[model samples]
Target: MNVLLLNPDALRGSDPAYPLGLAHIATAAMKAGHAAEGVDLFSENCPETAIFSTIESFQPDVVGLSVRNIDNQCMRAPIFYLETAKNLVHTVRKRFYGPIVVGGAGYSIFPREALDYLRADYGIQGEGERAFVMLLEALEANSKAFSFPGLTRRTADRVEWIPNVPLASLEGVWADRSLFPPLPYLDAGTRQFPVNIQTRRGCPMECIYCTNPWLEGKTMRFRGPEDVVLEIRSLSDNFGIARLTFVDSLFNHPTSYTETLVDAFLKARLELSWECTYNPRFHDPHLLSKMHDAGCVRVSIGNESGSNLSLTALKKGFEREHIERSVLDAKALGLETVCFLLIGAPGETKDTVLESVCFLDELNPSSVVVTLGIRLYPGLELSSIAAKEGMIDPRQSLLSPAFYLPRELEGWAESFFLDEVLPSHPNWTV
Candidate 1:
C-alpha cells in the first residue's frame, strides 16, 4: 500500500512538529510490508494545487492526514490549518477514491466533530501506533476497519467511536526520532532539526482545567532509560539531531523518572539539549540539579493560575508555594523555564485574577505564555462546572470550540493579562 501521511499543522497551535505519531504509523505500515510516504503541509507555502500534485505524483492507496491542532489555542480562532485541512479533504474527496483517515493529538480530542467537519471517511483517536498499521492492513485486504482499536467512523446518521485503546508499550514504538524534519526553535533563533522522543505518556495530576486526566486516563508510564538513550543517540548520529522536546504530558512526573533519565543522558555524554513540561507539584532540589547536569535547557511549568482562589477552583493540587519553589529551584540550577498562565477558568473573579498577577510578579521566569481562554470539553471537571453555571450551550458538543470565561468577565480577563500579568516580565507576550 502506498501511504500518504499529511501533517496539517500551523506554527501557532502546533510547532513545526516532526509528525511523531504520523511517522510511527508510516514506519509501522512500511515495516508491515507496505510502501509509505509522508507530506507535511507545515513548511509549504502553496495550497491545494501543490498537495494535489504531491498526492497525484505519489498516488497513494490510502491517505492519512494528521491534524495537530483545532484552533490557535486562543479565542477558538479557526486556525488557517483547518481551512487547509478542509480544502485537502474536499479536494481528495473530488479527485481520489481512496479512504481518508485522520489522526494526531488535536484530532484525537475532537475526533467525531473533526471528522464530521472535515468530512473524512474515518478517524483514529488516542494512540495511533496500533490503529494506523491495522487500518493499513485492512485497506490492503479491501475490508472495513471498524474493528480496529482507537478508530472512529461517521455514517449518514451519526458518528460512532470504538473503545479507547490501552496504553501501547513503548518497546517497539518510542517514536523513531530520526524521521522528524528540521524544526525552527522557539526561543533560539538558530535553525534546528531534531527528532522528538516522548519518554512517557499520561499524567496523574487532575487539574480541573485539564483534560489530560480524561484523555490519558491518569496513568504515568515511562519507557526504559536505556531504551530512551539508545533512541536519542541513534537519532542524533543518523539525522544530526541535537535538540529534543520530551512530549510527555508532564515530563517530570514520578520525579524519579526525570532523575534517572537525566543521569543516563549525562553519563552517556550524548550532548543533546532537550526541553519539556514539568509538574508544578514537584520541587525537589536534588532532582532540579540533575536536570542541569543532563543538558536540559528549558522546562515549561503549567502555573495555570496565580491565585489560590483560582487554584482551588481549578482543583490543581499544588498551591502558590509549590509553584514558587519549583521556579526558584529551576532558576537556581541554571535551567531556563517558561511559565504558562491560564486565566479565566470557571469561578474566576477579579480578586483571584489579581492573585494570579501577583504570582506572576513574584515568579518571573525566562519566558511566559499566557492563555486567555479555557475549554469546556466533555468528561473534564471544567465542563461540569460550565454546565452548572449555564455558561455553555446544552446542545453543543464540547469539541465545538466553546470558550468558557464567565459572561461578566468577557474581555476583562484577556486585557487584564495584557495590561498586568504579561508586562511585568522582561520577555513576555500573549
Candidate 2:
C-alpha cells in the first residue's frame, strides 16, 4: 500500500512547525512494509496546487491528513484553521478517489466533530504510530475489521469512536525526518526557528484548560536518554541544526528523568542550544543550573496567571510563590525566561488581573505572552464551569472557537491590556 500523509497547517505569522507526528506515522507505515510519502502544505506557496500535484503524482492508495491545531487559540481576532483543512480535503477529493484519514493533536480533541466537519472518511484519535499502520494494513487487505483503538469512522447515522491505547514505550519508534526535510522548514523561518523534538509523552497535571492529557494521555512514557541525544546529534550533523525545542507537555516532570537527560546531553558533548516548557511544580534550581550548563538557553513557564485566585480557579497545582520561584531561578541562571499569562479564567476579576500584571512586572521575564480568554474545549472542567456560569451553551460544539471570560471583563480586559499592560511592558506580546 502506498500512503501519502499531508500536513494541512499553514497558520500565518506563526512559526512553521515540522510535522513530526506525520513523520512518525510515515516511518511506522514504511516499517510495516508499505511505501509512505509526506507533503507539507505549509512549505508550498499554493497548498491546493501542492495537494493536487502530490495526489496526481503519488497516486497513493490511501491519503492521511494531520491537523496540528484547530485554531490560533487567540480570543481576540481568532483565526480558525479548519476552513483551510476543509478546502484541502475538497481539493484532495477532486484529484484522487481514495480513503482520506485525519489525525493529530487538533483533530484528536474533537475526533467525531472534526471528521464529520472535514468530511474525511476516517480519523485517528490518539497516538498514530501503531493505529495508523494497522489502519493501512487493514485497508490493503480489504478487511472490514476496523474495530481498533484510536480509529474512528462515520456511519450513516453516527460516528463510531474506539478509545485509543497509547504506546507503552517509545524505544524503537523514531520519526522518519527524510519525508519532510528540515531544510525547507529551516529556510522558511528565522535563525531562531528551532526544530522540535519530543523526549517524552503525557502530562499528569490537572490544568483545567489543557488538552495534553486527552491527546497524549496521562501516563508518562519516556524515550531512552541516549537515543534522544543521538537523534539531536544526527540533526546537527546532517542538517547543521543547532537549536531545538522540546515539545513535551511537561518537560521537567519526573525530575529524575529530566536530570538524566540533561546528563546525557553533557556526556555526548552536543553543542546545541535548546528550550522547553517547565512546570512550576517541579521547579529546582540545581537541575535548572545543570540544564543551563547543558546548553539550555531559554525556558517557558506556563504560569497561566500570577494571582493565587486565578491559579486555584484554573486548578493549577502551583501558587504565586511557585511561579515566582521558577521565574527567579531561571533568571538567576542567566537563562532567558518566557512566562505565559492566561487572562480571564473562571474566577477572573479586575483585582486578580491587576495582581497578575503586578506579579509579572516584578518577575521581569525576558518575554511575556498574554492570552485574553481561555479557549474552552469539550469535557474540560473549564468548559463545564463556563456552561454552569452561562458563559456558553452546554450543547454548543467547541469545534468553532468559544472562549470563557468573566462577564465583567468581557469588553474591559482587552482594552486594559492593550492600553496599559502592553505599552509599559515592551517584551510582552498578546
Candidate 3:
C-alpha cells in the first residue's frame, strides 16, 4: 500500500516545531513495505493544486494527515488560519478517495473531537508509528479496523477510541530522513552544523499545561547512550554537521541515563555544539561545566511560572527559589540560560504575573519568551478546569483558540510583557 502522509503546518502556541511525529510515522509505514510520501503543507505552500497533483501522481491508497497544533498562540494572530486548514482538508478530500487519518501531538490530545470536527475517517490517538502502521496493515487486510488498537473512528452515533497498550520496549529505527528538507531554520549562529537527532520519547514531568504524560504516556524511553553518540559522531564527523539538537521532551528526565549519555558525548569528543532542555533538579554545576567543555553553548529552562502558588497550581515540583538558584547556577557555569515562561495558568493573577516579572529582574536570563494560556488540550487537568470555570463553552468547538486566565488579567499580562518587559529587557522577547 502507498501512503501519502500530510503534515499541516498550523499555528502552535509553542515553538516553530519540526515535524518529528510525521517523520516517525513515515518511517514505520515504509518499514512495513508500504511506500510513504510525506508532503509538508508548509513547505508545499498550502495549495490544493499541489496536493492534488501529488495525489494524482502518487496514487496512494491512504492519506494520513498530521496536525501539530490547534491555533496560533502568538499574540500576532494570522487571520483565517483555521479556515485555511478546513479548506485545504476539504479540497484534499475531494481529490482523494482514500481514508484520511489524523495524528500528531495536537490531534493526539483531542483525537475524538478533532476527528469529528475535521470529518476525518479515522484518528490515531497515541503513538502514531506503531498504531498508524498497524491500522494500515489491517485496512489492507480487509479486517475489522474499528477493533484495531490505538485507533479512534466515528461510528453512526458516537466516536469510539481503541485504547493503546502500554509500550514495553524501545526500538531505534533510523528515521526516513529524506522526508525532511535540509535543516531550513537553523539559527544563524550555527547554520553549518549538520544532522540532528531525537534520541528519546515521552517526558516524566507533570506540568499542568503539558500533554507529555498523557500523549507520550508516562514512561521516558531512550535509545542507548552509545547509539545516540554514534549517530552524533556520524553527523559531526562524516556529515560535517557540528550542531545537533536532541528534540527530547525531557532531555534530563532520568538522571543516571542523562549522565551516562553526557559522558558518552564527552568520551567521543564529537566537537559539536548542542543544547537541550534540562531539569534544574538534576543540574549540577560541575556536570554543566563538563557539557560546556564538550561544546554546549546554551541551556533552556522551563521555569514556566514564577509564583510559588502558580508553581504549586501547575504541579511544577520546583519553587521560585529553585528557579532563582538555577539561574545563578547556570550563569556561574558560563552557560547562557534562557527561561521559557508561561504567564497564565489556573491560579494566575495580576500578582502572579508580577512575581514572574520580579523573577526576570532577579535572574535576568539571557532570553525570555512568554505565551498566553492554552486551554483547549484534552486529557489535561486544565481541560476540566476550563470547563468548570466557564472559560470554554460546552457546545462551542474548543478547536478554535480558547484560554483560561483570570478574567481581569485577560489582555493585561500578555500586553504588559510585550509593551514593557520585552522592550526594557532587550534579552526578553516573545
lDDT per prediction?
A: 0.74, 0.89, 0.73
| Lowest summed lDDT window (length 10), candidate 2 | 184-193
Q: What ranking of all candidate models by TM-score puts the best one first?
A: 2, 1, 3
Worst 10 residues of 1 by lDDT: 178-187
Better of 1 and 3 by lDDT: 1
Q: In candidate 1, what are the lDDT values of residues 1-430, reduced to their tens digit?
A: 8887777646633445667777677767777788777666655666466568867898988888888767665663544356667777887776678889988777787878888988898898887777887877777888754476688888898988885665656666655433345443233455464446778777777787676765665776668899889878877776667888887787777887788888889889988787888777876778777887787888888778788878877888888988998888888888898887777766788777777766776787888776777866666777777777887766567665776787767878777767765566557767
Every candidate's CA RMSD: 2.6, 1.4, 3.1
TM per candidate: 0.91, 0.97, 0.88
Better-scoring candidate (TM-score), 1 or 2: 2
Q: Rank the candidates by lDDT, best first.
A: 2, 1, 3
What's the CA error at residue 12 for candidate 1, in Å?
7.3
- Model 2 gets an lDDT of 0.89
